[model samples]
Target: MSDTPSPLSRSFTEELWGGIASIFEAILAHPFIRGLTDGTLPEEAFRFYVIQDALYLRDYARALALAAAKAPQEQAIAMFCHHAAGAIEVERQLHESFFRDFGLTEQQVRATPVAPTNLAYTSYLLRVAYAEPFHELVGAVLPCYWIYQEVGTRLATRGSPNPLYRRWIETYGGEEFGRVVREVLQLTDRIAEALTPAQRAAAARHFVTTSRYEWMFWEMGWRMERWPV
Candidate 1:
């Protein structure tokens, strides 16, 4: 047998990730993700996802800034602040490129109502950032960083014929983004070392909950989710 430990037998961060294996599998199986891999996704669905994502990033940046404020260490604070800036940069650059390609103007994207799942996901993160302990906030946000990296890395192997989708995969699958995710994972493990059993459980709960949201976000995009009256 290999020397590598199974996910369930691993330490904090790995254990947390392993516990949500089912959800991650579902996310990979999601139509939205599969379409990205095959480059068959409809333009309308992709447009809606990009718009919702741009809106989502603005609030996500805020939540990151809030996490920075709550961080106890200088390094942690700096990391969160940098991530916050990075999130905004992604919105401005990646999303903007997509917007232009889709013939969407900034005004139209801004005026577009936030999709229901998009709003709910961001609201959950912001609520955790404002109200939860720092460790829990980290748990809440980690899925976005970790899962995207996983998805990107996986899709990059298959590659899409569509240039735009290929660009999206490359962004997350690049070494720099992988390094960013690794840093956060390391930080999560370090934070876990100091947590009480109860605290660890709480953090795990948030991780699992946000993970479900991650899957839902894709499902929403697949459905081109809208707010119904």
Candidate 2:
């Protein structure tokens, strides 16, 4: 296989991305991401994020499995299934490494309560997975894939002084993750070609909403957000 990065589709999926240009810029400028670049973010905040992400990935994998089940084409089904398995693998390998570095056991991570934003984010995804059409589900999940790759690629340019943070950056910034995101983008374009105008609008709405949620997620980690109650 060629090692060159795949170009992202310039079709309807491109329009969806263009519509959110401002949101994407804001996400890149988010303090949590900036901190990742500078290595100034606190270990406590990182720990909270790691724990919450572990929680998020559990649901995210489920959502991907649902996507696989609902997929209209055999190729799409296989793709989603592969992604679902990849999600679980990331949780196991990446999080476990962080857990050891942070002196956290799996039991402690399990016992830790999911932060409010983390809960809200995953809940939205699961709701889409269970109830929404496949197109909308794909829209909802795209930001997590796309934004992380963008953030990681950008940060990997400067690189982090913190080894742990560098490792995190490498995961998303690597060519492997870029290839996966590009595949999803291509799938999104394929699905979009057949969408009704109304369906396109609804899918766009889901995409924007989840993109906003992606921003909130970083803030949640930065603040180490907790339940108000």
What overall lDDT goes with each candidate model? 0.91, 0.90
Clashes of each: 0, 0
Most accurate candidate by lDDT: 1
Badly placed stretches (over 4 Å) of model 2 are 1-10
- What lDDT would candidate 2 get against the real structure? 0.90
Candidate 1 clashing pairs?
none
Q: If scored against the real structure, what TM-score would every candidate get? A: 0.96, 0.94
TM-score, model 2 to reference: 0.94
* Model 1 stretches astray by more than 4 angstroms: 1-9
Residue-level lDDT of model 2, residues 1-229, one tens digit each, is 9876455434778789887899989988888888887999898898889888888999999999999999999999999999999998965799999999999999999999998888899999999999999999999999889988988899889889999899999999999999999999999999999999899889889899999998998899999999999
